[model samples]
Target: MSDDQSPEPQIFETLQPADLASRVADQVLRAIGDGRLRPGEKVADARLARELGTSRAPVREGLRLLESQGLIVSHPRRGFFVHAYDADELKEVYDLRECLELHAAEAAVARMTKADCARLEAQVQKLYDLADEGQTQEQVVQDFAFHRMLCELGGNSRILRLFDQIAAELRAGIALVGQLYDDPEEIARSHDPLIKALRARDPARLRAELHEHLQDAQIHVVQLFRTGAFDLTNLDKLSDDQRNRLLR
Candidate 1:
């Protein structure tokens, strides 16, 4: 076609109200989880509205929802700040993750269809591949993906929602602990039995394996605590170095 006869470019339309709200909230939550928005970082509604290209009304509504979910806190005059990163709070987050994730594992064993097992197997294989490749970042991502898939297979929205909320807080501590260890392989080994139990569809074995997984998670966090690395300020700062190392 001649230049003058070229087709016009397509233009995307606006997001649905529900989609817009969810997208805004997800962006903000991801920022907080990734340390881009550190604990105590002020969350200004006007700034959020501007950044998201939406009105302050929806931003305020999003903030209110996040606050109620315990992800953000609004001070009388200081506006909203990221919360739930204190040492004790991290402990609580991990504990809750353990409870829900263990149950999810059990449920998954009971409810796993062939297709669900296939997906779980695929995620498990990815974890193994990432481990073999020696890509620590990809290994961590796949590791979490395996667990997330298991939760999905559990067929329980209530449990999945609870796991989703706690995963970020749990990840903060895990990322913090990364600096003090060099044993991603050792960590990756934990997934084998969990996958095996799922393949067998044995809830008892799945529950046991999950308990062991969470125990190890707890131990890893405790090690970070002992190293004085899990402190909120230390975690936030060390994360900069961690990101740089991963990039290299």
Candidate 2:
């Protein structure tokens, strides 16, 4: 290949015409989740279209989809940028996540099978392996996958959909902030209680364990936000009601 030639984009020949925009959105969302794209980074539709081997129309549609999910922002006149991080937003998202995931835990506990438990256990093991290897990005993805597996086990399509809506943003937030735990092994082991609770099919225990898990993450991210480690320019853009929530 020539020095200036870009590598070929991943082909999407098998996808139906109707799903083109969604495929584009997923690719871009993965890029954000994996930290290939950074917060507040400009996303050029034309550039993305060329890279994805698609027309600009679908790329524009994809950007709009990401914007609605709180992963991208559209600035008037300038164009789309990755959404900047905010502590208040992170807290709110995690609060809602806790509610949804606790409910999911209850549902999953009631219906969870041996296979489901095995899948979750394997996922947790992969997280430990990734952390041991010092693969931060892969660790982030595995962490999200473990929770996503819980949501899937709950068997509520809508609940899983709702969880997925924030998946990209959650991954991006963790990626942008760097490491959340001092010891990667400690981070991997944190999920053990939840797994044990799931195996025993104890809703109460699962709920308690899940709550602590999310709360610890919330506390960590809030500390990072307060320390001025993340971008907060967008916080000023929020209205009084929004700001009040942040203060609370």
Reference-based TM-score of each model = 0.76, 0.72
Q: Candidate 2 clash total? A: 0
RMSD of 1: 8.5
Name the candidate that leads on TM-score: 1
lDDT values, one for every candidate: 0.69, 0.74
Task: Specify the highest-lDDT model's number.
Answer: 2
- Tell me the tens digit of each residue's lDDT in model 2 across 163-238: 8776655643444323587778777899999989988888999999999998888888777776787553433333
Candidate 2: minimum summed lDDT over ten consecutive residues — where? 239-248
Model 1, 157: alpha-carbon shift in Å?
2.1
Cα error of candidate 1 at position 35, Å: 3.6
TM-score, cand. 1 vs. native = 0.76
